[model samples]
Target chain A: MKPETKTTSFDLAFYDRMAAVLNAWKHLGEIPLDKIPPHGMMEEITRLLYLESRLIDQRRLREWLDLFAADGAYWIPADVDYRDPRRTIAWEFNDRRRLEERVERLETGQAYSQIPPTRTVHLLSNIEGMLADDGLLHVLCNFHIPAQRGQDHQARSGWCGYIFRKENKHWKIVLKRVNLFDADQPQSNLSFTL
Target chain B: MTTYSDHLPSLDHQPYQHLFKPGFVHRRLYIDEDIFQQELLYLYGRTWLYIAHESEIANPNDFITRRVGGRPLIISRHATGSIHAFFNRCTHRGAIVCREPRGNTKGFICGYHAWTFNITGECTSVPLRQGYGKSFNLAQASLQPVARLESYRGFIFASYSKDVPSLTEHLGAAARLIDQWLDRGEKEPVVVQNGAMPFLVNANWKTIYDNAGDGYHPPFSHESMLKVFSNRYGDVDMNYYGSDFDKSPMYSKNLGNGHTFLDQRPEMHKLSAWKRQHVMPGYEVMENALIEKYGEAHALPMLDASTGSGMNLNIFPNLLIIGNQIQMPEPLAANKTLLTWFATSREGVPEEINAIRMRMQEDFPSFGEVDDSANFEACQEGMASIPEMAWIDIRRHQDTKVGALDPADQLWREPMSSDLHMRTYWQRWQELMNAGATRALVEAGVA
Candidate 1:
């Protein structure tokens, strides 16, 4: 969908500064290259990303809930790499109850777009380091999403931001953020999770 | 699959294409090189082809590379805050200067000769200033700007020829649909909801357009989705396919102007009270945008109206405006018959809500194995007939003139049919196709 008119103008100056900061975040893979990401953290984060992709791709969906915090959320913006979720619309938004319902509905009954669950291989790369002020370690990564369900070869690039805190000696996801490169661009059907 | 290479290369045969009419379309329109070439000139040349939106290039030096027909185009924001789109080919050599989908670049430097141009498409530097001798002036060659570029509501459009009607005029009657979609209250601006889900379909591009505003496909075509929704909510959510099924319904409407829409949104939301809440936000800024643009009461009802999510409407040629769902719903876009969906949102609801919305959006039968089945079934079925079919029917609603279009009705002049909308599209197509080459759109009849 193309714009009908320019009704919303973002803070251009701030957007530029943010874009630069985001770009610098891309090169951050250089930092932890010498030392492998901590195994436990890596395992935990990898599981989150993997579990997220699995629900939508493999359709295991029912198990998706085990991962999220009660207040956890999911977002797919209308525009590519959309920075502020407040400004644009999202394709999906779910709290814990809603999220569970989605999986339950997909499993027990007929899901429209699920004639086949999406097949996806999310390449998580560009890991960056950020220790939050709130005693939480936030790991950032750029996700190269290449998916194929039917004829469409869905390839997307996104920046992932996750806030993790140690819970019971294991990394528990506090907040997981995904900013798609084309976040602000208009979209078609995204019947599955990203 | 054979359709990929089954093209007929000659444009000459297109003149009397109505003659050999063995089936649906004269192969030339689909497989002919001449028709493709003409499309670049007539259709894309003078039409307000969609480019990137303002949000995509929000800052100076920000750039995105997209394709217009087969030609590469560059969309960028200059320091002056003006957005510009031009052919991506560098003047030095016919090469795509920008390869990345998006970036922030000060200027374009051709890898071949290093001819540099700033945001204005001006030649700022060249690798060998002395190589051209005194005869080569840098000002003579710069990035060529599109003949006409304008954007309405952040959506950027460009045309190779300036003679076509103004963007508003070109949008003609269809602009109302855009307005209705965004008006919330009449003062609101519809912000980008979710990123686009661009997928490729094996079928022709027209299939998606033909199906988008269709009311006939849901019960059976999207049975899985309908069944799923029905199973969960105990109803298909469609007035037509729900508990009350109308096998043969009235369809095809002429919205007077070229613009039109199918009556599906009303039924989808009617499935349940929960679905109604799923339709609109508790109170949205989009409503405020509408109130600011139109009025408060207008914005409230329009945006708050309970409706099914998929209200896919298209602006002739390309550019389709689809549903703005509150949950994990995405919009389906057709790129020359290839189907991809974008998960859209109204902008910054809660992440938790967006996640559920994304799940609902992406975890559907459409994106799963069934999309291939759904689209392929349509394409294979539509094209199965002999190539010589006579005048494709657009007469679905011609019999009963009224609201709510039925996809079963595919004829022009039907009150419920958007096929009449097609009449405008065809008229525009014929005007361009008949003009032949070299006869550019001069803001009047072509050749």
Candidate 2:
């Protein structure tokens, strides 16, 4: 029997809509306490982000994948001003399906670039609530990850904007956008997750 | 203060000539800083380096900053739409004039002395004009322009030496290929995508250049991508390394003037057609839209030609138009190189067509580039560790081969895996380096 696989239809309209949604969330700023989720819910959301970072740092990619919604996307804009990924190049613009494939490839020992995978310490700070409407919560934070591969060490710092939604009573990532400080500058190997 | 020539290797033509054979290159060429410096002066200094695409500075008073041959330059367009390239340094204090990567302004004002220059690189005003005597000429005070600047089909290139061949002569047969790729049956001109993706690789710039037309490494270096492609498509046979892959028709060509390219139209067209028919998301919608707008005859051929034209065309020195990406490499040091990828799109093409192009860019940095980077870093590390092993082989199909030749263009085409393309690059490098060294010797009264 052939192995079962999951696929998402390539819909330009769907992608366009998602881009609009992401643009809105990316521009969202700190919201008033009344407009955001309850204080306890806000803390839980921050905890989930910390857990996600820990999972990635531990190289538990599968567990990290579990934190994202089925339709979630991870994007890193090539432009600091955030040009549409469909019209321009991006450091990464992976949909849920593509993300799964990336995780699967990393799991395979044959992925040459990751043979001696880099070890990373992800430090998350400046967490702030942006918006909570339409059953989605937008949050923003700053991250500094120091990664070491062989004898080389690189410090990657970026601002992350995430849109979270509740799925089965657990906060799941619906969208994640990272804007690297040096996105326009030349970069060395970013083989591991940021 | 040591001059640049003082740092050049003492060895002359004889030693440099011995460094390259028909199918071998000396390891010193990759690791030696002296050779690297010489290359910066001889090879890069004389070549018609790609500086920017005209579309990037289409509007009046628009400018973009870039580094050419280790020197920062600003490419600017004036109100009349005339484009000019100038040294980014100010004349007074030599401070960088254009600090931003890209912007639009009527004129540039040097932060140090408030020296102002118009978009055409004419010195418009000086903060202390009265302080200078008649000896100070404002006409000569403008930012120093590059020796020569030219454009072909909106692609801009600049050379440091006025004595160098005209841009047309320099491009030669490579010009035809670029025109074919850029035109692509589109009425409107091709423009660069909004932004460029820049990334660094820990390897010699030549290593990256050599890989541009390399066909042997993909099957091995990008094995994971092929695997992922298979997993995602559920039809492994359509992958680049599929069992049904026909190797005979696909070939690499050594276009003169240090340009080399891989021609895989038959294979690429077949893959593109297959994807459009079976795999590509929204393929049917795109096809319908194109057919309705352009009619069946025009739309079908355009689609086929677009798919077939995706190839690796490296215009020697720094520019590489590989598939949909216009890539350029800047050599920072002997072991450090920065590569920038600019996505190109036809101005009037369907949005879906450009969407697919953007998707193709993801295939690289995510999978192919990292793999290539590993190999590049490994090659550099290995060559540095062992000075005893001096030669790297490029002799795969050197001795025995039946290859096609295009006499009019002076191009020789051979199987994809052949070393013809790499051999062509080294030959051009040797010729240019020897010429530069000879010129230097004559100028120094040593010849």
Candidate 3:
């Protein structure tokens, strides 16, 4: 599905305030950490993406299961109004249990496609969004995962790989959608988690 | 007009005994430029190459632009509800007029001097009326068509040569290849829901084509896959990855036309019970439909979980299909070929069904086991650069019965089971290459 192509340019002051929150929120001196909410949240966001992207790109699969909460879900919608999960086709959807099972199978090394794991380097930028009605940060960010194995090099842009609501302080991935410009065409097999 | 011999070694001259004897194919078929060019004519050109589906370009002015066998062509839905395909290039300077891969255009406009054509390939607009003076005739300048364009249950294909047979006639034994997958949809237009094959390899294009038909490589190359499937299914022997399974390594190499269904045996379905327990509900309905059409016995056998069809299906030279309805598993290969996947359902099927299909695609096909295994083939960088030993052998099922269900049957399944398919492909290819430029494909299809 084509993602919301909003030109979300914020004011320079908005950038400054966010930067200040990010910087000041860090702790090094004193007895312990201070202003931990903002910095910790940023750290968590970066960590969450890096961690999830690692499992998917590395095909670490089993290790990947450790990251998701029991009730957590993975989604990649095929259409725009994907906000309502009931309406569209998502590339993947697994509750924690199913995800764990898949990972376990991957661990036993039954996965044929992963004899050589998928190598990936993700570039994340333009992070923005607000706290949703659910209290989880409604995070919106753009990431490009350029992956290669042996001689094949391909890129899966996250105009569609979405990271949805995260509840409480615990980072639970509510949704991850990937929309490729070439999504409507014929494809080879895609064994890894995007 | 380079005859196959004029170029280098000729197919007629090469002793074809290996093709008849050794079930294994020589690697030369993979790396040979001569074979690749010949296929562009003998196979890709003459065959009913899959071009586009009706769902993709539905309305007037709606068009899907793509390259067909080395030529720039556009498949468009005309205002009259008919679909047409024509060269996308302008007849004048030969510049491609339409830039977007797809769109609803108000008559395509060429940036080079603004030569314009309608969605029907009719020349619509040109610069100043006096530009070419009296010598020019606009009526004589309409866009040239592909000569023969036809659709089979919405599968659009075009042939450049006027002498070719009907699309159905060209399909021949090949029709079964399309039927295996298309039949799954119960005669509906097999909607390709945003599926894409995105990997590029350094090897010759035919290398990939022949590999698609090879049934032997999966166990040795994809033992990991077998291991993964075993783990997923709770089977511990891993013997399925070895030669212990009933069909052993040969069943996977058994699809006709150099296409094989590795797990097409009882051992394959015995392994799938675990998957049957895990799959979405829609699969049952789809499976039931297949059972009814193909018969309960044939259909049930396919569900053995071990019976997954090879969606990594080889559609002749350059196309592969994702086997069945759900289309999940893994990114078949991310780097070896350019992958694009469409999550298709009956155009009017419930939205939730589409969603489930989409989810499955992410977990498997577009990012599935097929892609990863294929990617490793590319990394064997060792496979390509070694001594002139470029010829990999497909002699595994050399005896026609080696690939056949019963050795008594005279008809061998060719490249998939016997070397007959490759030999046929190569020999027919030789005929076209020997004919040279007048053969249309070698002359016109080549840039």
How good is the docking of model 2, as DockQ? 0.50
Off by over 4 Å in 3: A1-64, A75-123, A144-169, A178-194, B1-29, B32-47, B176-189, B193-197, B234-315, B319-322, B325-343, B348-352, B361-380, B400-424, B436-447
Please give each candidate's TM-score: 0.64, 0.91, 0.70
For residue A37, what is the lDDT in candidate 1? 54
Q: What is candidate 3's lDDT per residue for A1-194, written digit by digit as tens?
A: 11221212112232243234223322213322332236567677777777776667666666666565543445444433223333234444454544554565446554555556567776777654444334444455677878775445787665523334554546766544455444444333344566
On TM-score, the candidate that comes out on top is 2
Q: How accurate locally, in lDDT, is each candidate? A: 0.52, 0.78, 0.50
Candidate 2, residues B231-344, lDDT tens digits: the string is 666543225545423264677898887889887655656644424322233345555667888898777766654442557899998999976688899998999898888877
lDDT of 3 by residue, B1-447 (tens): 222333332223332335333334455444445655555655455544566777778777798777666667788888789998888899879999788778887578888988788888888767895878988888667788887888866667677765556666655444555665565423445465354333333435544545554444545554543555444444432334465333343333233333332223234334453243334323444454556666866655444322233344444444455434321111122113332334455454434334444444444432244644464455345454575654555554444443444353333442323333344444444444444433443345542
lDDT, candidate 1, B221-285, per-residue tens: 55554444444444333424653333323333443324445545444444342333321121132
**Per-prediction CA RMSD (Å):** 9.8, 4.5, 10.4
Worst 10 residues of 2 chain B by lDDT: B274-283
Candidate 2 structure quality by residue, lDDT tens digits, A61-166: 9999989888787877777776776677777777676788788777767678887998999999988775556788878889999999887898999899888888
For model 1, the docking class works out as incorrect
The list of candidate 2 runs beyond 4 A from truth reads: A1-29, B1-15, B185-187, B234-238, B242-246, B271-308, B406-410
Per-candidate interface DockQ score? 0.14, 0.50, 0.17
Segments of candidate 1 deviating more than 4 angstroms = A1-60, A63-194, B1-16, B19-38, B55-63, B77-83, B103-106, B152-154, B192-194, B230-252, B255-259, B263-275, B279-312, B325-395, B398-427, B437-447
Give the docking tier of candidate 3.
incorrect
